[model samples]
Each structure stands twice: as structure tokens, then as C-alpha cells.
Target: MSQTTIQISQELQQELNRMKLFSRETYEEVIWNIIEDTKELSNEAKRDIAKARKEIAEGKAVTLSDLREKYKIQ
Candidate 1:
């Protein structure tokens, strides 16, 4: 297969490295694995996500991280 080169920031590269499941997993495999996971979410969950995004765009929702911090979750 033909291959391509893309540039990513050092921080992003480190995050990708941290996501690797094994020493031999390639970047393509890692990206496709994430894509597969998003495709696996249920229709109800997907609709809820769409609704949440719309709410956030309307400035009507608190992000989970912010809510977690507000609740003092570790």
C-alpha cells in the first residue's frame, strides 16, 4: 500500500504513544481503532451526543470535566 507522511506536534505524538496497546501497534492501527470505537456507540447514545453538542454550541451545558471539578471528583 502507498504510504503518506504527516506532521504532528510532539505533545500529540506523546499522547498517541501513550495510547498504543503493544510495542508493534502502528499509528494507522491506533487511528483506525479509535474510528472503530466511535462507530460502535449505540444509536441512542449517538443521538444523545448530538444533542449534547448542540447544547454546548448554544452555551447551555457544562462540560463533564468542569462538572467533575465542580463536584471535586479526582
Candidate 2:
């Protein structure tokens, strides 16, 4: 939405310049990858929450002690 300049270490900048890593294709692919990963995690979180709510509504939920006993954990 807005343009801003980010400062980086001179050594890192020099490395990027030397490698010519500022290509449009590289930037586009990186952004696309980040968005895709975020979407997948969001969907997974929603599914897990829905499952928990369903379990609670169906009276299948347990208390902390129940969980500890079920798992045999201290």
C-alpha cells in the first residue's frame, strides 16, 4: 500500500548485488510462497478449532486431570 526503504547491512547488500538476486520473478515467487503458507496454516487452525468445539458440544471433552490420566503423564 505504501513505499518504504529498508536498510540492510552493507555486506549483505554487497552480496545481493553480487548475486543479482533482486529479480522480479524471484520477488514474486517469494511473496506467493508466503501467502500460500499462511493460507494453509489458517485453514488448519480453523479446522482444529471446529473439531474442538464439536467435541465440547458433544460432551466428549475432558478436564486436565482426565487428560493427564489418559496420557499417563505427570
Q: Which prediction has the highest TM-score against the true structure? A: 1
State the lDDT at 36 in candidate 2: 75
lDDT of 1 by residue, 4-26 (tens): 99999999888888899997899
Cα lDDT tens digits, model 2, 1-74, are 57566677899666555544356444335546657767745788889999999999999988899999999999
Count: clashes, candidate 1: 0
TM-scores for every predicted model: 0.52, 0.33
- Name the regions of candidate 2 deviating beyond 4 angstroms: 1-41, 67-74
Q: Model 1, residue 26: what's the lDDT?
A: 92
**Candidate 2 versus the native: TM-score?**
0.33
Alpha carbon lDDT at 62, candidate 1? 80
Q: Residue 62 of model 2: what lDDT?
A: 87
Candidate-wise lDDT, in order: 0.91, 0.71
